[model samples]
Structures are given as structure tokens and as C-alpha cells.
Target chain A: MALEMLSPALILLLAAVLIGLLKGHARTAVVLVAPLLTLWAVWQIPDGVQGTVKFLSYYIEPVEGSPLRRLFATVFAIMVFVGGLYAYRVARWYELAAAFAYAAGAVGVCFAGDLITLFLYWELMALFSTIVVWCGGTPAARAAGIRYAIMHLLGGVVLKVGIEGVVVGTGSIQIQPMLATDFSTWMILIGILINAAAPPVSAWLADAYPESSSTGSVFLSAFTTKTAVLALILLFPGEPVLVGVGLFMVMYGIIYALLENDIRRILAYSIVNQVGFMVCAVGIGTQMALNGAAAHAFAHIIYKALLFMSAGVVIYRTGKSKCTELGGLFRTMPLTTVCGIVGALAISSFPLTSGFTTKSMISQAAVDENLVWVYMLLTAASAGVFLHAGIKFPWFVFFQRDSGLRPKDAPWNMGLSMILFAGLCILLGVFPELLYPLLPYPVDYVPYTAGKVLFYLQLLLFSGLAFFVLLPLMKRTETISLDTDWLWRRAAPALIGLIERLLGSLGELVARGRVRVQRFSQRIAVRYLGQPHTADREERGVFARSWPIGTTALWIAGLLSAYVLLYYL
Target chain B: MANQDEPLHWLVRPATIRKLWIGLSIVLAAVVLAQTVVYIKGYFGVDAWFGFGAVYGFVCCMLMVLVAKLLGLVLKRPQDYYDDPDKDTGHGQDAGQKMSGTEERGNGA
Candidate 1:
């Protein structure tokens, strides 16, 4: 008997539906088993487009395979499994459903063969991820979810316009490498960049992700931006503008993270920083750089999830998200503390960690290309990464002065997820051979040369030194740092209020004009038609008085006689 | 909650941490010294300078911290700056109270 095999996305989506319908343990079983099944399905798909159909005039390739696609899909499936484990016990039933839907969207995007298929999955993510944010169920979460939805919906519209433009301009809808030369491609780039948390509009990431439920945030940390990186790698590689854009994001992330007081917010800003490295690598567009970008994204999702899972544990146990309110957690939550540090070190690209294995290739690419200034700036940004995220996160959240809050370690499942990812971080770092082969291109680079290790160690350690030396200055405050979101969040509303007030005054002026016109007409009616009521005639003023017909005739005759006399003269 | 007299975990004690910091700094300095005996390869001209990574890392970090501090003057606002005044009680509420609220909303975890 022949059987139809569903795409991995459909498998997860179906599981989400089943989970949403059931309660208690059945839902959990579906939640846990669904991702494993999806992973198996992901591995089963062959090397080319398998699921193709004609929709309207276009051929839709929903199941496509390549090393890059498989690489991203593999990590995504792992994320679902791990993220599901972290979230299973704590997350609401609906949140689990939404989260699975979100994951399915991301996996779908990874396997999409054309822009149309990509856009479909892209929007599915935009929608469900917002629901995941809303699952926080706090007033702040509700507001953040609305803002998140608006930003992504706008991005969706832009992307749709771009796709339509491309389709109309050239009669193809296939996903292929593109340049940002024409308006359509530029729109497409901007659309993807928004999801990637690119500048001026990057505020949405920090504003939303931190507000999600702890478990939701764990899922939130993985998918959306990394998928955007995948999209960029697929299209617009070697676009020179991305180099500048990526650098801006790197420094911006560091500065903002340093300024942040909320521990989760710090992590959120660091996401921008890490993704910046990937974006920059894609801009480099060399085979090694592309490999670096893909490898980094793969590595990044694991470690970043590990970090968020740790933070989630803290928030779960102590119910505080701000660094000022955290600290001394290491005393009670030793496992979480260690896991978080591992994640932090990996994020900092520490030697013998996943980051070192993946992130250095981009810098090496910069060197190979001999882009002097870009190389220097990227090197410095690496140190900044170590400074802001590497030391700052662990120190403030785990080891700062005792806040008298002693939270217990994470629950077993959450701890298991952390350990799995932490082990992966170290494993991938120590054995880059495993990850390198999965990369899109051939691997010729050696990550652990003696000289390279020494250089990185020196950079990381001194950055550590600077952190302590300037420790007195890194005090936490009860403040929020404003960003470009303020343009839409505050300024747009303020402008609307200003316009409303201006219109109010205009309405008053119109009312006053109507009153004057009413009075003038009343005067004209009395003067021309006379006051018909004799009883009120005595009360009438000069303008409202009746005029005699003879006086009017005599005035008209005098004006006519003057005109005739002047003409004769 | 003030357990000042309670013996801390040995790894986290103030004295132990201080010693640890000193040990780490010494190790870092030793690595810096090793750079002299074994010169690290550099792709760019500036990277070839002895102790370049250490000096650049430190200076860049210092600049980043200082610049961030300067930005604080303009960028920082009260924690409840964006909150609805009637809804949010700001950061002054005790952690216990806020935590319960978060938990009640099913969002603390």
C-alpha cells in the first residue's frame, strides 16, 4: 500500500491542533512526541523538491532539501524537542499549541522552495509568535503582544508587496539568490531585515521577547530572527550594505545591553548582537563566510536557548526579571548558574566553546578578503560581546551582591533541556568536525590553532578585566532605556493628539463663523423685510430696525442721479 | 531572609571570590607575557602588535562602558515609565508581592 508522507510542518501543525483539543496528559504526550516525529520526518526527506503542486500559474515547492536547509531544519527540530521539554510542564495548553504552530512555521520556512511558500510560513510565524507572547497573560504582555503583532503585520505586508512585485516584474516565483538592486528586492530585503531585528526597527525584538512567559520566551529566543538569517543567506548574500547594517547592529546591541537593567532584556539585546555576526558573514558572501553564518545560526540557537532557559528558570523560581532584583541565585540554583555561564561563554565565543568554533570563520573571512576596517571593527565587537553578554549576564544575575532571594534550581525537565544544550555547546566546540560537515560548504578552516587560541584568550580575558575594573560603573538602575520604538509607541500617538487638538480648534472656529452668519442673516431679514411684530419693534436696535419703503426709494434715486450727473460731466 | 551568619557555599564566599579574581588576573597576565615568547600571527598589520588583543579588548570595553554611561543620561527612564499609572505600581513593590502577581497570572514561569 502506498502512503502519503506529510511535510514536517504539517506534522507539527497537526500535533498543535491535537494538543489544543486535549487537556492534562494527552496534550503533553502529543507535545513531546510530535517534535520527535517531525525530526524523523525531516531526516527522511530526500535531496530535492519532493512535494510540488501547481497553484494558479505557479509551481509550489513546499518540501526542498539541501545541506543548508537540512542544517537549519535539524536545529529547528531539536529546538522544538528541547523547547517543548522546557515549556511542557509550565506552559498553558493554548500556549503550547501556539508555540508548536510557531515552530512549525519556522521549520516550514527552512524547507520552503520558493518565495511564495516562504512568505506563507513567514506570516504563520508572525501570527503564532505573537500569540506566544500574549500567553504571558500579563497586562504588559498584552500590550507588548499588540505592538509585536503590529510590527510583524507591517513586515508581512511589505513582504507580500515585494513578492508580488517580483512575480509581476519577472515571471518567476522560485526562491533563488537575489540582489538588492531593484525596488522589489529592496522591499524583500527590508521585510526580512525587520524580522532579523535590523536597525531603527530592531526595538521590536527587545520590546517583545522579554515580555513573553518564561517558557514562551525560551521558544521565542530560537525561531524568528534565526529564520530571517536563513532567508538572508538564501537571498542577498554579499550585499555590501549589509556589512554596514550588521556592524551597526553589533555595536548597538552591546551598548543597549550594557545599559539594560532587566536581565532578560540584556539577553534580548545580545540576540541582536549575535545575529549581527551572522548578518555580517552573509554580507561577506565567501564560501567560508556563508558556512560561518549558517554554522553560527545553528550554534547560536542552542546556546541562546540555553541562556533563555536559565533566565526562565530564574524568573520561574524567584519571579524577578531585573538584574537589580536578582543575584546570589548561584547559592541555591547551582545547576542553573552553571548552565547559564556555559551559555554565556559560548555566546562570547570563548575558546573550546561552540561560539569559538563557529564565529571565528566570519572574522577569518574578513581577513581573507583583506577588509582592514571591517576586520578591526569585527574584532572589537567580539570583545564587546564578551564584555556585555559574556561576563555581565552571569555576574549580575548569578554572582552579584546577595539580594536575599534564594530560588531553587530549575525543575527536572527544564534542567534536562539546559544540560542537553550546554553539552551540545561544549561538544560542538571541542568537536567542530561534526558541525563542519553539516555546513553548506566544504570546511578547510581550523578553529583551534595555537596562535588563534592565544589571541582569543587574551581578548576575552582582558575584556573580563575591563569589566571588573569598570565594575563600579556597571550598577543597575530602576530604569528603561528608550529606543526607536518610541517613534511609533509615543511620538505617533502624540502627533495624533496634536492633530486632534488642531481639529478641535478648527471646529470651534466653524461654530463661531456659523453664529456670526446667523446674526448677519437676522439683521438682513429685519432691515429688508421689516419687523413684522409691532410689539417687539421698540426693542429692536439700529441694525435690526425696520426701514421705510420711501426712504429706501429716495436713497436709490440719489445714487442714480449722482451716477447720471457724473456721466454727463 | 537575612542569613548573614549562615555559611555560604565555598565557591561564592567573598574571600574565595576575591582569591579567585586574583588568580584569574594572574593567569591572564601570564598569557600576556607568553605573547612575548610566542608571537601570535596577525592578518592585519595592527593585530601583529604585541599584546594587541589585550590592549584593544580593554580599551574598547572601557570606551563602550563610558559611552553607555553617557547614553544613560538621556536614555534611562523610570522602570514604570511606559506603564499605565493605575495598573503598574512600579519597581518599589516587594519581590514577594510582585512575584505572586506574576504567578497568579501564570506568567512568572
Candidate 2:
């Protein structure tokens, strides 16, 4: 009889407020319960515009339900719960609060029924995620946090402009699927893609995420980009531009990650690569592809968080993140090692892993669409994923030559969270039936055919061979590779300096010309008056004085009359 | 802190590692060979070719590594390449220079 008045998002935001009010074990309990409560709230809302309100001259739907919405919200809720467990022991109380607030924004975005509400929640995520990044409390974190904030704020402004344009152009504020027929729609797509870590600006993900506190990075890995993937699926599915953009991101991520040395940054780049699959699936826009994007986003959040948690434990124990400095931790940190490998295999789309079940659907969609190039590229990228992340991560960090370091396994809560997600990774892969019905579309596609399994095994294993064979070539260096951020980080400042120097010389030349003119005018005034002007300051010539009011008026009139006369002639 | 001279876990010993690598190589060769027996069909004719997955994966990975190597020539810089000159102190552009105190702190090592 009662219409569900409260959204899960509000529950999370309220929980954040409550968390800020409490401390210690009490705050942990609040963190743990809040997400479960939000999940319950998420399930209670039924399909079709659950809550609406009238504002100004327009009506806004704040909560809308569909299979897609529930799927995204469910994963987000799960992320918060697991992420909370991982962070509850290690994070400062404020970081946990900010993370809850960030998750709340992502949850709100999933339920948003209109463009205005979506924009508001989008910016909410930008604000809180920046706070989470700054929670890293290092110089690099501080700088990276500032850059992260600026990038997201710029993206928010673009999205806001698009939303306003769409409202003005269509006379409606509803957030339904639309084509890129106009500037407004394209703006919205570009805005979403930027957050998706689509190229050129994709540098922010790798730059900022690795700098966050280990626990903070776990939360950061889940929310911002995945929310963007959700937005793309909801708002711009079947937009063709995303296909090309996604492929670029896939290869770019692989190459950059291949060149990386820091442990977290490798995972950071791989996140972009993995999201590329979802973005491409959204571009394919078939029911299957949309399902794949949604399903993959769900799988990605779990596996990626698992990976970050494992790495976080390493950094927590050893105080080192670079592969060069970390090796053979499997000796002492066996549980963390196995968990990290599980995450790595999942990410690589190894057979019988969550990735194998979900990611193949995107490639299947690509083939069904007769996108030969896309299908081939996705297959090749799968191999590269294994080479760069699948083998590279576990090999260097856990099982390579000994670096004489013995760090402890993750503490109880962290290990418990990792084990839970690791179990889900396999569970989802083995029983994908559990996931398929939860997709936005009806269930039809199957993932585990014998041929498909064999093909994937061959692809992944050979990539593994390439890794060990090329191990010497892939040695970690004590150097950083340049990315597109170099344009602003180094080149832009140098360009600005050059411009300043040129302007300085020009100003000097103009000053000399003015002095000469002043002397010329002084000689003319002395000649006309037959007086020595040096004797009195008041006798300074017209050019030396600020221009007289009448003279300036006469010059302006003369120029105007000349232009007018020329026109008449 | 534990001394580096302490004995390591038996599984991680250097001799064990060499054996593990040999075992892994044999297992991988078997996996590549299994592709022939299972006869996995591919979407395209080119993909269906013998050892296609292995060849594709190996060649693509090799290209990826080599291209990354080429890129490193231009892209790689001393770890402190971006740090302020004043802050970097002794670690001035030279590879041989010992890192300054500030550089060590910045690396968080």
C-alpha cells in the first residue's frame, strides 16, 4: 500500500552522515549494515518511474527501475559492502565516510530517471571521489587528487551543458536512450566517455588511482568509471563512435600497462582496458551486447576490487609497490598471492573464470554484427591482457626471483573480503545462470561451449608462454614512461614561458617607441611656445600628459568619419 | 625486521623455481597441442587455422613487447625527470648521479 519513498542512494548518503557521527567499532557496524539496507531498498523498488516530483514548470522522475538499473545498483551495493569490509580496519574514519558518499552518488546515478537528477549525482561522485583520492595523504596523492578533481569537474560542466541543451531542445527532462543526432547528445556521450577513461584524458586513472591509500584505491577502482559504463549503456547504447573509441582504449591500456613498473598502476591501466570491452559492447548495442556490457561491468568491479585489495595488502606489509622492489612474496604471503592470481586470471579472461563467461559475449556480439575487425581486435587484446596483466602481475609480484622480502598476509578483514570476492568470481563463472537472468534483457546467450573454452585456453596459455620467454625484455626499470599528460605537465608550461618572454620584449619595444614619441611632442611644444619646457612640470607636452579629453574625442571622430567617407565613396 | 639470511619457504627456493619453470613449459606445450585434438572451430577461416590461437597470441604478445620496448626509448626518463630541478639536487639529469634525499622521500621507498 505504501509507495517506496526512500531510494537506496539516500540510504547510503544518510549512512555516510551517520558514519561521520560515530567512531571505532560502532562506525564499522554502521558501514557494514548500511549497504545491506541499501540493497534491500534497491530490491523493493519496482519497474517504471518509482518516484517523481514537480519542480518549476517541469516534472522530474528521481527513481526509475528496470533490469539494467537493478543490476548496476546491486553490484554497486555489493562493492560498498565488500569495500567497507576491506577498509573498515585500515582507513581513517573520514575516508570511509567519503567512500560511502562516493558509492551513494554512483547508486543515485543508477536510479536517476531524469537528466537533471543524473547530473547532480554525477557531480556528487566527482566531489567525494576526489576526497577519497586525497585521503592518500602523500605529495603525489595531493597533486594527483587536484588533477583528478579538475578533470572530473571539467567533465561535470560538459555533462551539465548537454543536459540543459537536451531539456531545452526536447522540452523533456527524462533520461531515456537517445541517438547522437545533435550537439547536446554528443556532449552527453563525450562527457560519459571521459569518465569511462576513453583516450587522451584516460591518463587520469593510472595517475591518480595508484597514489590513493591502498584501501582507498579499492573503493576508487569500483565507482567512477563503472558508473560511467552504466551511464553509457543507459543513455547512448548503439552509438557507433564508442566502438572505435573503445578499441583504442583497449590497445592503449595494454601498451601502457606493459610499460609500467608500479604494481597498482598496472591494474589501473588494465581497468581502462577492461572497461573498453564494456564500452565496445555498448557500441554494439544488441540486446546481447548490452547484456554483456552490464554483465561485464558487474564482473569487472568485483575482480578489479579483488586485484586492488591483494595489491593493497602487499603495499600495506612491505611499503613497496614497484615490481622491481617486490618479488617472491608468495613465500610468506601465500593467501594474498593465490587471491591475487585468482584476480589476475579473472581479468585475463582465463577459461572458467568470471571474465571468460562475461567478456566473450561482447566478442560474440561483435561477430554477430559482422564486425570482423572489432572481433579480431578484441581477440588479440585478450591475448595482450594475459601478457601484460595476467602473467606480468603475478609473475613479478608474487612468484619471480626472490627480492628477500617477507611480508605478512592480509589481516583478517582484508583476507575475508578478498576470499568472498574470489569465491564470487569463480561462482559467477561456473554458474553464469545466476548472473544472466539479472541482466537487463532476457536470458538466451550461453558462454561455455567446448570450442570456445578451448580457443580461450590456447589464447591465454600461449600469452603466458610469451611472458616467460620474453621475461628478460619485460624487466622493470627505475623510470617512468611519459603519457599524453606530458602535454600539460611539461609542454604547456614551457609554451607559456616562451609566450611570456616574447611578450616581455614586445612591451619593451613599445615602451621605447612611447618615449621617442614623448620627446618628439616635447620638441614640438617647445618650438611652438618658444619656452624652455624643462623649467616647469606643468608645461609637459600632450603626449607626455595623459591624452586630453578633447584631443582624444577629435581623433576618434576623425577615424570614424574617415571610415564613413570611404564607405560612401 | 627479519634478517635476509633467514631460510625461505621450500616452494620458493631457486632450485624449485627452475623445476617449476620446466614443468610449466611442458604444460604449456601440451595446451598448445591440445588445440589440435579438440579441433576448436573458429568464427573465421583464418582463425580456424592450425595453432591459430597460439600463433596469434604469441605473435601479438611479441609485437606488444617489442613495440613497448621501442616506445621506452623515447618515453622512459630518470624517475625524477618531472620533479623540480631544485628539489632533485644531486640527481640532476645524469643516470649515474646518486639520488637526492628529496628524491628518495618522493619515491616512498
Candidate 3:
């Protein structure tokens, strides 16, 4: 209770703001110190830190503790530290502030005890992450940031509705498993799926991430979707639909990543692909599968960050992000080249890397479930990952034809951060037990079986072979790939334009009809009033002019005679 | 003038095979060390495990390099691949004018 008295997230958030108040190395020191402090606070969260406080009729539980939560929160904290290191030299103090706030939101999500707490942290993550994207300070970044915000806010609204429905119907706000057959639960699933960059709106990630600043993309790669993965693992484990959706995302990411020419966009697609594995594991819902999802999320954040850092180094040194403008830079930047290759291999699930240990569990689970088709697709996607991100990224940026540009190696801070992440990727891979114990379940699953390792090697190596064999099809171009988001970004806008045109014509016709009616009414009024002789005759005929003295007496006599005649008849 | 015509610009030349061999050797050594650590942890301390690990790593690295070369073929584009030639015509002529100005400056100097 006393620990709850001081919100650790708010403390880090405020510290970040204060850090923004400082300048120079002092700013960097403060930025670096905040995550360390936040990490210490996070480590201090005792097991089962759950309680409820009443807000009117609503009871809110803000702290939930489990190994899964701890795993995600720990990685989020590590990301902050590494991101701070990567960003300290180049990013503005405000951007650092936003990054810390965003990290705090992610950590908050990890410990969120109830739906309300989850939604609160979820929306906070969305808000600060958008600010991080906008901090790129480019017109493109600003537009992408707006689109990102719109998508996230839409996700938040759907999530809020679901949370409210669950609370109203169930009378409890505790975060727990729910079945998909229920309407409220389905809404919640959809809300979280959107954040996970699931289809139909997944374009937001690729659209926004590439537009972020060089440093911003590194931080951007860490939090938003991983948090959604954590939420799904917690709430909707064992849902069959997720397996299908996850496979779609996996292939979707690979094909689109194959099509992308921007270095950051390729990495963004890979994020979706990696998260797809985790989502599938959550769908499996077995103990090993859940652990796989959790472990994969942990490894994903590190390796993805490494990949982004490498891309960031390239962009920072050259001021170019497109793969076409970059090539043959390894001659100048060997450290960056090495770091990128480490990340690439790790992401491709090479036999001795972090991705190999974590991603295999999900595939193993698919096999365990006897889902032959899903397993085969996942195997193909594993190879495709190497083709699109693992090979395409580094090959284009570092080892392609000489572009005659000789940029210096990445700055010391950037190189150091990359090395740290590279080491982490290898550390987790070689010693899976270190990460395995940190998963939510017991550590019974082994990732180093000979059959599994050899299978992965053959699959990934063959994919590598295919990449070499099909190099002509993967050429870089300036054109953006049309994604599901095109439905809203392009098609929706065109539809709106067409509707506006139709309404404009209809409105003109209505106005013309009103004018005609007004003219007709005026003509009738003039015809009735303008004829003076007819008007006078009509007035007299109504007994207005003849009812005077003699006219009134004659009328009275005539009326009396008529009455007598009628009576006699 | 001799230095200018040396044709040994680091940016334009591929890395020597010697350097590639050294780098490969270092990566193999790291993988062996990693396997040794794994073996010592009571997991599978088989004889010649490090050797196996090294060979495995070397093969993977070669495969990755081959993949990288192939990807380059597929993904590589000309520096100006995205630039529109039609739009660049006017700018190209302006650049020509600037080149002439620079040449005049060179002569004047």
C-alpha cells in the first residue's frame, strides 16, 4: 500500500521532465539516470502486488505481478536505458522526455491489475509514442504522426468501450481471461489486435515509423506493439482466430517488407512479423506456447532495437534512409556493418542467436498441436524473414555497389548501444536458460534440440539461397507499397471526394427549385393584388362596400323574403 | 599527381580476402567460446563440441554472405533510381551552367 502511494511511473515521468530542464551532458546524465531509477523501482515491485481502490462505483487495481509482467517490464526498462544511450547525443531534450514517458506507460501496462488500469496505460503509451514520432521535426513526420494518432485514438476508443462493457456487465474490473464468443471480450480482443498492428490497419506502423527521426525510430521499435502482445498473452490466450490472424500478419509482413525500399520500413514490417510469432504462440495457449510468446517478445525488443539502431546509424551519418542511396558503406563503417549483421542473423533465427531460441518454441507448439499447414507456412515465413529484413537491410545499406560516399562510422554512443544490444542478442541465444526461467511458466522446453536446430538451419539457409537466387526480383524502387491502410489513406479519401461532389450537385438543384417556387409565389401575389378593379369588385361582393345603409336594408329584406318563401314551400 | 592516379581509394575497393579471412576466424572463435560456455554448464559437454560449433557457425556465416550478395542483386538500385529524369532535365541544365561558371572561375584564378 505504501509503495502504491508513490507511483513509480509518474516518478520517472516527472524526472524525465526535469531532465528536459537541464542542458548538455547534464541533460544526457539526467536522461540516462531516469531509466536506471525506473528500473530499480520496477525491480522493487513485490510479487502479487494487487489491490483495489474505489473511484465512485469503480474499483481500480493498478498493480498486477507475475513472471510474464516482470519479463515485459524488465525489457521495457532495458529498452529505455539503451534507447537513452542511443538518443542522448542527437535527440532533443523534449524527445528524451517523451521517450521516458512512453517507457513508463509501457511499464505501467506490464503491472496493470485491471482493465481500467490497462486502458489508461495503453492510451498513455499511444499519446507519448505519437509525440516521439512527431519529434522527427519533418513535415512528413508531422503528417505521419497525425495519422498514427488517429489510428491509436481509434484503437483506444474501441478498447475503452470494451472495458466499459466488461465492467458494466461483469461488475469487476480485474484483468482475466475471457472467451471470444462474448461481445465485450471480442471488442477488447479487436482493440488489442489493432495495437498489435493486426491487419486492415497494420499500415500505420510502416507508414509512421519510417517517417520518424533517425533516433526516434529506434525507440519507436520497442514499445507499442510489444505491450499489445503482452496484453493478448494475458487476456486471450488459446484463441484459435489469433493463429490465423498471426499467420496472415507473418506473411503480410514478409511480402510487404519484400516490397519496401526504405530501410526503416523494412524493419517495421519485420516487427509485425516477429510479433506474429508471439501472437500465434498465444493462440496455442499451452504453457510452453505462452512462455514462447513471452520469451519471443523479450528477444524481439532487443533484436529489433539492434536492427533499428543500425539503420539509425546509417541515416544519421548519411542523411539518407532509402536503401538505394546507401551501399558500400561497410568499408567506412565496419562496426555498424558488424552490428547490423549480428542483428540480421539473430532476427533470421540463425542457430546460435536469441531469435532461434525464442521463435522456435512457437513453431514447436504449432507442431505439437499438429497444425501442419500453419507449421509449414511459419517455416516459409522464417526463411522470408531472412530475405526481407535479415539480408535485404544490411546488404543494401552496407555491402551493395559503391555509392562513392564515405561517411564516418557511427558515433561512439550509437556504436556502444548497438554493441550492447548485439551482445544481448547473443547472450540470450547461447544461454537460453537465462531467459527461459524468466518466462511465465516453468522451464521445461529446450530450444537446442538437434532436429529442431538442423531443421531451422536448412529452412533459413535455403531461404538465404532463394534470396540469392531471386535477387533480381527484389530491386529497390521509390514507390510505396499499397497496403490495407490504402483503403483509408487513398480509397477512403477518394470516396469522400466523390460523395462531396454528388452532394454539391444535389444542393445546387435544391437551391434552384427553391428559387423557382419563390418566383411562382411572388407571381401569384402580384396577380391577386395588382388588378385594382377586380380587387375592388371582390371586396364589394363580400358585403364590405354594399352593406352600408341601403345595401344592408335590401339584403335584410331579401333574406327575410327568402326565409318566408322557404317556410311556405 | 601519382597519388591522384593510384586508384586505391578505400571506398571503391572491396575488402581484401585476407581481411575477410581474419574476420571469419574471429567470428568462428567467438562461436566456439559460446559453445564452450554452454558445454561447461552441464548441458552437453561432448568432445569436439567447440569444433562442431565453429564449423556450424562458419557455414552459417558463408550462407549469410551468399544471401547478402544475392539480396544485393535483387534489392540494389542506381543512386538516382527514384529520381524522375523528366523533372531533372531542367536541373541538369542548370548544373551545366554552374559547371561552366566554376570553370570560368578556375581560369580566372
Candidate 4:
């Protein structure tokens, strides 16, 4: 009966299945309704209710009361709704189903109170997200999906090992803040970092996200890394190493995004960049920093999804993603262009957008902690965000060289979703209270101020000046930029090939030696054991061949006499 | 849908600088209005300043475009960079359509 009451996770899971059973417009309607139902269920989760169950030897607790968890779950549920609307018409029912299940996993993760529950939901998220990637219905999509799954499963394995160690060592599975001094904690941190797309393996995000279907990318962009961020915040908050790691990721994303030719890849890298900010905030470990990280995750999901949806529409209509192949489409798809620009501005942290409100708090915390260099780097990264995502994406996709393609605007459902998210971005930007109150910590920080606002304007505007003046240098081309991933993707493969060849030659040498040794041993055995002169003499009778009868009688008598003499002696 | 061959007018070309200015001004006005509302709601304070975030955001975007453009000069191959121009393999359905007649030699066999 309680299960029948429909939790947010259950509602979304059912909606996904129901959508798969429907067709065409009916499927679209089902997709739209699914998120709303989940939203209602999220709202119904009563405060301070600790939902738990015992299975096997472990206690699974998914607490449903914390403002932080509620905030994330709420936005996740809302994202599913908006994403559903954006994708309803074009996407297959299976994709929609996977998307909802993925959203449910995210929500389920938010409420997971114990390590076991968290791990379960975390792997589930991986499963459904992989399905979403495969639903792109392209060869590239399939390949990307496989790569995505491998990376996620690797992360999951590390996490499972860490969880087991922690349970064994601590004798408790409560989800609590952990220090990185011990092996188990370090294992868990590594697990979370992998999901966050920290360096070396970070290329997976850019590599796989763009290959997904347009609608699929929208869902892909929001959930995975952010969930990792949440996990990190829950376990390993305040680890100073994360600050450096996060900063590296932020700058790495911007640089690579600048070099990327694909529009979605640019956005994908920005996801890394944005999550970097959150990661840094978590490292800061102050109440303000934690709050900032939580709030940024909330806002980032909405705006990033909006950007992806806008791009999806363009790609859907034009069948081109490269900036060089596309341009000046704003003439026809004005609404999409506007919505995209809005998303772009928000991502760039333009004042009065969701980004400005949510992202600035982290920087402020950095300043408070007197992390002068980190603050400056973050500020520069903020400027770079505008350059890569704010201007580059919109400029190339909607307002560059006229590609002479006259495609209709995105379908009504897609348009409506974009409009809704665009409005939310602005709304939260103007009214930070709507989100600030939902942070895990008490809200004492203000987002809008004269001095801070002026300083940010000066910094960002100069960055814009730099971009326009150097336009010739920022042209789009069809090339993949190399990163740390290149080591594994290219160099590692080459190294493996060389090693294989060397091993093959060694194997040949061993075979030749074995043959030579076998022949030598056989020859020696034949020489020592052969039947020859000795055996023939023994078989032949004494003097039988010549002078047989007469000589034999005399010889016998002489032999008898010799035998008697020998016996007496 | 407008015809592709129509003569270019100032208002429509680049969607017109005038239109660009107008649209940008409208966005600016909207931002101002939103700020005013926040201010009235007592949400604006020492933390909620627009000038810095706006200018910073704009400059950052411009810089990104420039960097991408510079990279493009070196990195951008021709439109058919990945495809073999002379090899009418027809393996790529879209590529086949784009390269119907030209049979130039491919760089990498």
C-alpha cells in the first residue's frame, strides 16, 4: 500500500515505462505528465522522514527530509519535466523511458541516507544514463555509450570497494563526511572524482556527450557529473586537494572547449568547467562554500539543460553542429536563438542570470578565505566561460556566416520547454531567495552588491573586448583537440602495439630453443641405448660358425678341465 | 520562409546591426527591470551589482571567440577533411551526397 502511494522515484520509473507503451503524440503527452507527477511526489516527501529497509546484512536508509536533498531532488524532477517536453516529439519512447529512470536514479541518490543506498542509486543512474546515450540511434552514439558505460562501471567498482572497506573498518554505513587520510576514504574520493570528470579521464565527457542524440545530450548534460559533485559534498567535504583538482578542471574545460569544433562538445566541456566551480566550493568546506556548491549545482542544471535543448533544436533542423557549417539561422529560428542566448548569458554568469547568483558565492568564499590566486584564476575562468559558451556557442550556431538553410523553429513542445527554463534562469537570477533557502546550510550571503557587481562587469566586459578583437583567432574548424585523454586514446594504444610485437618475437625465440633442445636430447638417448656389436656377440654361440662338431668336443673337454682348475684355485 | 537569393538589405544582413542593437537594448532593459524588481523586493544589496558581471561576461565571450578563431586557422581542415575526395566509397551516405561529382585524389588511402 505504501509502495502504491507513489514516491517521486517510483512515479518517474512508471512514467518511463508508460511512455514506452505509447506512440507519437500520445507518447509526448505521457512524457510531459511524467515529470509533473514526479514533481508532485517530490513535494509530498514530508520533512524529517527517514525511509529505510533492511536487506541481507545491510541497512538501507534513504532519508527524505534535508533541505539540501530536497533542493536537488526538486530540480532533478523539474529537469526531467523540462527535458521531457524538449524531447517529446522527436525522441523514441525507449529514450524517454530511460531518461525518466535516469532522473529517478538521481532523485533516489539525493535521498539515500546510507552508503549502501547511495551506491545502489549511483549505479542505477549509470545504467539508465548509458541507455539514454545508446538511444541516440547512431553508430557513433553506440560507441560513445559503450565508452560511457565502461568509465561509469569503473567508477562504480572503485566506489563499491571503498564502501566495503568503510563498512568493514568503521562498522557503520551511515553517509557522513570523510577525511582522506585513510585508504578507504581515498578510494571513495577517487570514485567521486572520476564521476566529476577530473583530469586524465575528463575527455570522456566531451567525447561521449556530443555523440548522443540531440535530445539525449540535454539529459546527458545535467545528471551524471552533478550527482558526483553531490556525492563528493556528502563524503570528503573540505579536502584541500580538491581545490587544486577543481581549479585544473575549470581551466582545462575552458581551454579544450575553446579548441572544440562541435557545439555540443563545447557545452559538454563547460559542464566540466561549471562542476569545477562546485568542486572547489566543496573543497573550501566553509558553510558559505558548501552552500555555494549546492546552489550552483541547482542553477547549473537548469541553464545547461536549456543550452543543450536550444542546440538540439538547431541540430534537429539544420543537421549540422560545426560552427563553420552553420551560421545566421537566427533569421528564421528567432525564438530558439533568443533562448539559446539566454542560456549562454546565464552560463557566462552575466549579472541577473541564475549563474551570476549561484556561481559568485563560491568566488566570494574564495576571497573570504584569502585564496588570492585561486580567486583570480576563478575570475579569469568566469571570463573564459563567457568566451567559450556564452559567445562561441550562440555566435557560431545562430548568428555567424549565413548557411542559407531555412529550417522551421523547434517543435512547440521543445519551444515551450526552452521558454520555461529560460524564465527560471532569469527568475532565480532576480530572486536568489527561491534557491538560497534550500541550501544545506543557513543562508547569510547576498548575491547582488554594488562593488562586487561593478568589479565583475569590468572583468567580464574586458574579456568580451578581447574576444571580438581576436575574432580571427577563434574560428571554428573540424579537429579534435588533444588532452590528457590522448595519452590513453592514442599514445597508450601505440605503446601496447609495440609491446605486443616484442612479446611475439620473444615467443618465437622460445619456440626455436625448445625445438633445438628436443633434437639434442633425442640424439644422446639414441647413442647410449642403440642395439649393436655387444648385443650381437651375446646372441651368437661360441665357435658355432666354424669347425663345429670336432672342435666343439675337444673344446668341451678342455673347457671342463679349465673349469675344474679354476674351481680348485 | 524567405528566399535565399533575395537582395541583402542593411536591416536583414547579419539580421541588421540596427536589429542587433535593438535586441540587445531590449535585453538590457529587461535586465534593468529585473534588477529594479529585486531592489524593490529588498534582494539587491552590496552583493547584487550588474555592471561588473555584465562587462566581465561580455569580454569573456569575445575572448573565447577570438581564441577559437585563432585555433581554427591552424586546425580547420577543408570541409572534406575527414573524407577522401576521390574515393567514391559511398560508405558515407551524407558524404556521397555532398561530393557527387568531384573525384580529386584522397590524401590517405
How high is the lDDT of residue A523 in model 3? 66
* Residue A311 local lDDT, model 4: 90
Expressed as tens digits, the lDDT of each residue in A265-315 for candidate 1 is: 999999999999999999989998999999999999999999999999999
lDDT of 2 by residue, A90-197 (tens): 899889999999999999999998888888899999999999999988766777888899999999988888888999999999888998889999889888988999
TM-score of each: 0.91, 0.89, 0.81, 0.82
Interface RMSD of each: 5.3, 5.6, 11.4, 8.0
Q: Please give, for residues A486-526, the per-residue lDDT of candidate 4 as tens digits.
A: 56655786799999999999999999999999989766654
| Candidate 4, chain A: TM-score against the reference | 0.89
**Model 1 Cα displacement at A125 (Å)?**
0.3
- Give per-residue CA lDDT, model 1, range B1-109, as digits (tens): 2247677768777788889988997999887988877769988778978899899999999999999999999999866666545445322332333454344342111
Q: List the residue pairs that clash in candidate 1.
A: none
Better of 3 and 4 by lDDT: 4
Native-structure RMSD, model 3: 8.5
Model 2 misplacement above 4 A: A1-5, A512-569, B1-4, B86-109
Highest TM-score: give the candidate number. 1
Best-fitting candidate, scored by lDDT:
1
Cα lDDT for residue A152, candidate 4: 90
